[model samples]
Target: MTLGAVAVLASVLAVSCAGVVLLTEQALTADLDQAAALRARDVASLLPAGRLGTTVPGAGEESSFVQVIGPADQVVSASANVTGQGPVIPAPKDARQVTVTLDSSPLGSEPLRIVAVPVHLPSGPGWIYVGTSLVQLRTTMSTLILLFTTGLPLLMLIVAWTVWRTLGRALRPMEAIRAEASQIGHSDLARRVPVPPHNDEVGRLATTMNAMLDRLEASSRRQEQFIGDASHELRSPLTALRTQVGVALAHPDPEHTRDLLATIDQQTQRMAALIDSMLYLARTNRSPPGSLTDVDLDDLVLEEARRLRSIGGLRIHTAALAAARVRGSTVDLSRMLRNLGDNAHNHADSTITVALTTDNTTAELRIADDGSGIPPGDRERVFERFTRLDQARARSSSGGGTGLGLAIAQQIAHAHAGTITIDDGDRCRGAVFIIRLPLSAHHGP
Candidate 1:
């Protein structure tokens, strides 16, 4: 990059300096030509005064000289500097003015800028030639050319050096980030790249990268914990099934064998349910969300209420069900609603209220049970996998169910780009799981 910048700058400078030299040459030559024309006019004025052969003042100092020629193109008179030279330039017939440059003049070896003008001399119509030396103009132009030839390269070198150093300094942080990122592994996610103090682009990039690393590390830790908990939960049913099988094998009683088989089936079902929940969590959390369709949330709420009513015992009140349409995976939404309803069923005493309502932007679903509410401290913890609370809030069931219902519900809600939270504003006798999902764009009254 630095080299390219220098090359571009050099090209521009070369073109500009060449233009300057050309313009300077034209300007200096124009001035010299004008001076020679004036000098020839003054010398012509002297011819009618009959002083054509007199020595001219200031004309001898430099190689400047004057001459007069007869109409027949013969040398008539000359300046002191070129007294014996024939007419340096031939005379013209008409009284027209002209200018020329002579490389080798009669006065000296230096070039001359000369102007010839017709004059009415005392002898007849003749021409006056006035000239000035070109040594000074040539010297000035040579010095300028020399300066540009040497100085332009020096300027380019300086520019290249400055650009190289500035770019290196700016990219130094990115190099450090690359090195740090390369060394990071799954085993060591705690390390972070160095952040420069300046609040520039590099600093912002480093900050963003570190933020991503922080999220990755937190996710990794959570995954490890989830694996450990899942292993422990699965082992419980396996241990029970193994012991029950061993007892049945050792005794072989017909009546107890039936019960043993039932127990084994129950443990196996529990293991299956746990594995299914884990798989669901993995799929929902690890992958992108699936294709979504508009689902009537009110229908799902009424369905859950109907299911609970069929179960008997508890009074399910869904009087607040309103027409709310949302966009989500229908099967996943159904499973989420079912898990919440099951959680309410497992904990409710005499009543469960399932409510659905909507506003301009979101649909809110609240499922509250009349059993003892979760403590304020454990409200968030209830969403964690296999979390157990006190006897009143512990998620227990006759089917040896895995305590993954709330976790599954929360994951499903998140997959729909929604939120599920236990309502802290409810000061009543039950936990209220309030889920807010974004309304579909086409939702209407």
Candidate 2:
């Protein structure tokens, strides 16, 4: 890029200098012609008026040739340089000046620019001619051309060098950024690009790159934490399954072995559930929702409530359900509802209330359980993955959950452009998990 820019600049400079040289040459030529005409006018004024023949002045320091001619088109008097030459130019029909070139002259074979002016002299009507050699003018123009041709390239080279230095200094910071960025790796996200002192584009780029590194580092830490938590959760079930199987093998009795096998199956199911939840979360994190359709949220709520009702321990109240439709993936919406219902069932003391309703623009589903209510401080924390609020709410008689239900529910809600929040229950002194989704366009009656 620098080379290209320098090349273009040099081209423009060369063209401009050439134009200046040409213009200078033309201006010099015009000045010389004007001086010759003035000399001719002065010599004509000194001659006898209405004269036919007059001795013109000799060649002077400025190297001009003068001549006087009679009305018969014969040279009567001539200057020293053109002493024996015939009339250098024909007499003009009028007094106006005219330019002519003399090809043959006593001085040399060089061309001369002559100006002829008709004058009325005492002897007769005559013409005066003033001629000047163009050798000096041509020489001056040649010198100017030589200087321009030689000096322009030197000037262009100097300019190119200066521009190259300036651009290198200006881009030094960017080079530093590139070098630092190249050294950064996934394991070293803590490193940042150096910011320049000047608040220019380079500085902004450095700041942006540092900000991206910050995000990558935070994301990496979260990933590592998630893997650690998942490994711990999986190990518990695997250890229990191995111990139970080992005990069953040692006993080898049919009834005892059957009980042991049943215990092993339960543990296996728990592990399967945990793995399934992790897979669901991972899938959702990796991709956005696909195949959206109008989902009847009320029907999903009622379905989960009915399924929980068959569990038989708690009374499920879902009479407040209304036709609430939302646009989202049906499977994701169903998973969200089931997660919320399962959480409520696991925590409720005696009764769980499931209610669904809609306002003008939003569909709301609230699931509350009559258990030890979640503290204000712990409400949000309980929704984090692998969080078990066993102290805040009693663990279900069935077992402690894998602690991913509320987190998965929240992820699903957010995927559908919705929000899930914890608030006080409307019917009982328990925690209420409210899910709010935007209403579909065709939702109204």
Candidate 3:
């Protein structure tokens, strides 16, 4: 049951119980007061005023003990109950008077409720007193109290039961939602937690949870597809190399076998390098750094460019260097420069230039290769995993290229809260890759 319903029921029951008790007490008191007043009136009407009529019938010669007194202080008649108890009641000094119980009795339980009136007749004026005990009043009130006490709790119980049942029924949508959620799996992300067509908090919660599930399912499906594509792409070269080796091994001739063996060796090297590149990308995805730290990007870029030059494959040059500080892994920075250098060597007219600089809040590394420039639209997506220029595949030599190199470089940059983009080179005629990294993060990696 919801807390709101329970609270409402408790408040209602409390107020009702309190009201019943108060109203009952006031009403019972009023009834008793009215009954007592009537009894007093009857007693005053029956009194006598003259000695012939004013004398109380039970009064004996001991007049002081039970006689009624007139206005002249003459003895008339007396009440046994009133006169028996000494000075049981004060002599009436006014016409309108009140009675006081003379002695204790069972009647005291519902004591006297009366008013005495002065009597006047041809003989003289005197006083008569009357009262009614509170016994009948008590019995009426007790019955009321008993009924209220017994009935009130039953009412509260009914209220509590109604609160629990109604609240549980109102929240029945949650049960359906739970059932739907329990059946949904990573494979069946298309399913959604059902939400009722109601503008309420529970409905809103169901909608929000369903939206979150949709996004998670989409991300999971994308990751699965990415792994499958990577596997297929990696297997192609492996299968070709294996077939080539089997062919060469079958043909045993001195010079021909040597040539075939060398071809096998080269293909084996490319295959191993591709596997390594795939592994590097997989690691970056698996363990992304929480932050990027201080790195000397200029030195890192210069070092990787020189290493590419070691193979004596491309004319690599650099802009006059400066201390370019950035928040990124040194290894990742070098990997980005080396991949750009290798890409340039693959297609350039043999020239590569590396540049580095820092702007407010953004530090950048730019590598330019005098290669056939990437088309404007394709430049953005080339860094996606396994994507390559359609032209690069048909070329006989590939400068040790694996399609994942640029993709790996992009992943590493993003892990550092940075980006890698391709732009127009020095003369705006060849591919230029620029990496941008954010600065001033206040926490650790």
TM-score quality measure for candidate 2: 0.78
Best by lDDT: 1
Candidate 2 residue 400 Cα shift, in angstroms, is 9.4
Prediction 1 TM-score vs. true? 0.88
lDDT of 2 by residue, 210-306 (tens): 9989999998997898899999988987898888778767767786866777777777888888888888889999998768999888878788888
lDDT of 1 by residue, 1-445 (tens): 9989998899999999999999999999999888878887877677656665645545665558887777788767667778777877766555788888889787578998888887776667878788778899999999999999999989998999999999999999999999999999999999999999999999999999999999999999999999999999889888988888888888789988778888778778778888888888888787855778999989888887898889898999888888999999888888888888888888788889888888899999999988888888898888888776753443244221577888888888988889999964245688889999999998998
Candidate number of the best TM-score: 1
Q: Which residue runs does candidate 1 get wrong by more than 4 Å?
A: 41-58, 68-70, 74-78, 90-99, 116-128, 391-401, 425-427
Estimate every model's Cα lDDT from 0 to 1: 0.84, 0.80, 0.66
lDDT of 3 at 264: 67
Worst 10 residues of 2 by lDDT: 391-400
As for lDDT, the candidate ahead, 2 or 3, is 2
* Candidates ranked by TM-score: 1, 2, 3
Clashing pairs in 1: none
Residues 373-444 of candidate 3: C-alpha lDDT, one tens digit per residue: 899989867876667786345422232365777787777788878888888977677988888877544322
Q: Assess every candidate by TM-score.
A: 0.88, 0.78, 0.65
